[model samples]
Target: MRKSDYRKLGGIVILLVLWWLLAYALNRHFLFPSPFAVGKVMLCQLQNTAFYQAIIMTLSRCVIGFVISYGTALVLALVTGHMKWLRDYLAPLITLLKSVPNISFILLILIWFNREISVMIIVFFVLFPSFYSSFTNGFDAIDQSLREVMILYPQSLWRQIVKVELPLLKPYLAASYESGIGLAFKVGVMAEILGQVPDGIGKKLQWSYLNIEMAEVFAWTIWLIILLVLLEHGLRLLWKKRKE
Candidate 1:
């Protein structure tokens, strides 16, 4: 392994040690379960079908929310990128969406929509501004010289977009996806918990919390961290492969 890998492993080890020490000192299994206890719970959960169902439901919601937000942002950015007046007109609304607290969105959306739809909408609200900003910034940063060259040549609009705009926008889109996917999952789960959706990781967490199953809570949390790390790492690898 590389030196960095070893350092990361060492850090994890230190954290586990600290966690164990704290749990031992507290001597309250229900309040602060040890790593071993949590690990055992995780193992049991892995054997259960419900755990997989919850994961799948949550992942589906996250993906759907991300796709909707990304597509909407891409379309709006493309239109507004060329229309300064429209961009200015939408600026206040974008700022409102970006500035509102996530919990506030969750509460308002819960009132306006059903529980499952509320979760998706909450994810949308949380992610749309960031995606839109990234895309518009990318559009604005595109080289004016290239556009001038295109104008001089007089290519078809589709050709110009395909050959010029999309190529330039790729990095921005990839960056937004990398950053936004995790946030989507987080916000979706939070909405699920607050909305009390029938089945999801958030619902499982709520159930565990209500039952005071601290070990299960810790186990679920560990799974979430692992999934997020795996997802980010997988995306980085895919992006690297695409570049190659």
Candidate 2:
């Protein structure tokens, strides 16, 4: 392993040891289960059909929301990147989206949409503004002379988008994907919890919490961390392969 990887592994080992020590001191499994207990529960959960279903459902919703959000952000960035007035008009709405409490939005959204779709909507809208602005900034940062030259080219718009904008926008998109996926996933789960969407990890968490299944809660939380880490690593690997 590389030096940095080893250092990170050592840090994780220290954190786990501390957690085990704290749980030992507490001597109350109901309040705070030990890491060992959580691991055992997680292993058992792996055998359960419902657990698999919940994870799949949650992942599917997150993927749908993420793709939709990216598409909408791309379109908006293209438009607002070129138009100052449009950017001015949308600034307040983006600010409000960033500022308003998520729960407030979820509650209102539930009144309009079903619980299942509400989670997707919440994830999209919550993450849209951040990514839109980022993409717009990337677009705005291009060399003005290069942009004018590209505009003057007689080639098709789609060709220009594929050959020019995408190449330039790649770095910003990669940065956003690397950084935003975890936040979007976590927020998506929270939305599911608030919306009480059935057959989802968030709903399972809610059920566990109400039943005071602290070990299960810890197990699910651990699973979430593992899932996020795996996804981030997988994306990085795929990105590397694509670049090659």
Candidate 3:
């Protein structure tokens, strides 16, 4: 095997050994199931249709919330960032949203919206301000000197936006997307679990908790972590391609 491959294998082995030791030390399956047991449960769940359906439902909610929040934030940030008065007007609202705890919105959503809509609402509220701030910061980071140079050559707004602003903001946009997407998924799923939305991984997790199926709970958590890793890496790869 190549050295890199060997190093990866060695790291995995070390991790597995540490996991085994921790599980043995804990000696309580309810609190800490062995990795093998969790793996077995994961394998079983992979064969079950319910698992896939739950995953799909959760993904739909997360993706919808993320896209809506991200798009809205991007547009608003662009508009407000260039307008000092608009930025001043928006500052307090953004600060309020960012300061409020996510769970505080849950009760209001549960009362005002259906259980199915609660996840979307909560995720959007939690995600929008962060994305908005990141984007506006990116816009602010653009050097005025460059814009002056472009203006000296009498560049059109479209040309300046395309050749300068977009490229400069690409990294910030990627970072915001990376940060916001996963946070949306996490906060959305938590809302779903708390709201008891049907046909979601959160619902399954809640059921497992009620039934005291610790192994299944661990399995579900493992799947969530796996999904997050895959999503993050996939997004990063796509952004890297665009940058190139």
- Pick the TM-score winner: 1
Q: Which of the two candidates, 1 or 2, achieves a greater TM-score against the reference?
A: 1
Ranking by TM-score, best first?
A: 1, 2, 3
Task: Please report how far candidate 2 places residue 222 from its true position, in Å.
Answer: 1.0
- lDDT, candidate 2, residue 38? 91
Estimated TM-score for each candidate = 0.94, 0.92, 0.92
Model 1 lDDT, residue 104, Cα: 92
Give the local distance difference test score of model 3. 0.87
State which candidate, 1 or 3, has the greater TM-score. 1
Give the range where candidate 3 is weakest over 10 consecutive residues by summed lDDT: 154-163
**Model 2 has how many clashing residue pairs?**
0
- Candidate 2 Cα deviation (angstroms), residue 146: 2.6
Q: lDDT for model 1, on a 0 to 1 scale?
A: 0.91
Positional deviation of residue 96's Cα in model 2 after best superposition, in angstroms:
3.2
Q: Which residue pairs in candidate 2 collide?
A: none
Off by over 4 Å in 1: none
> Which residue pairs clash within candidate 3?
none
